[model samples]
Target: MSLGAAPAPGVLEERYARLPAHQREKLNRIADTRRRLDAAARGAYEALREAQDDLRRARAALREAEEHTTRRTGGTLSLRQPDGRVMEFPARPWPPPELAQRVQRLEADVARLHAEHAAASAPAGVTTRLYERLLEHLGLRDLA
Candidate 1:
């Protein structure tokens, strides 16, 4: 059957009805297994997406905090030279204690998010591997 265009509405049903009873039963079992595997894959993908969103949020928060700190402390410095000339320099101060602590917390949050993302991705990888093995066993390795 061509995949580019779907079969007519009842074509699948008619084909299945023409099959022998034993083959129909086996096809039903395979369909059920495929449904379960698809659900598992979708769940794993959702988990990975959530983890990625969390990581993005944490990184955004860290960037905002750092920008705020920089804005507050990144001022210009000026000095009067002994020859009555004025010299100007940029003054970018180190992060204040509070800002430092906040940064440290955000860094930890990012690390945790990274770990969560990895954990969530592992299940999806395992599902793909299992599905590939199943296809190979069924002599459908081309599908894999």
Candidate 2:
């Protein structure tokens, strides 16, 4: 660890090398952590997408319902939720209970995506493929 001597070959690579008895162990641990996170991110992203799709479909259905009601009732669509909140649609942004709940969930998911995307910047471009490769090298790819 002296500073006066010239650095040896593979010095930089050796810096990441594990101890004699712990060869590849630290790297293995890091890869495992990254893999877990990658799996969690994939799950979260999938859930977000599903929730978003659900929200879209719900909103579209509500719109059609409102249009149909307005046309039939002359701009008066009475929708009674299970909680007994009967309100006239085409008047406020909040239409159906399902749409409202899904929108809220979607908004939360967007916030999570923003946070995770910000926190997930890998200098080596840790993409899904890269993540899988790392797992493969660690002999844990099959678990993923």
> Please, what is the TM-score per model?
0.44, 0.46
The pairs that clash in candidate 1 are none
Predicted candidate 2 versus true structure: per-residue lDDT over 1-144, tens digit per residue: 123555466653454443343535744565676767667667666766776676677668767666544322655556665565666755444455767777677778767765664455342245545555654565443423
Best model number under TM-score: 2
RMSD of 2: 11.8
- Candidate 2 residue 40 C-alpha distance from true site, Å: 1.1
Error of 1 at 72 (Å): 12
Tell me the number of clashing residue pairs for each predicted model: 0, 0
lDDT values, one for every candidate: 0.57, 0.57
As for model 1, its CA RMSD to the true structure in angstroms is 9.2
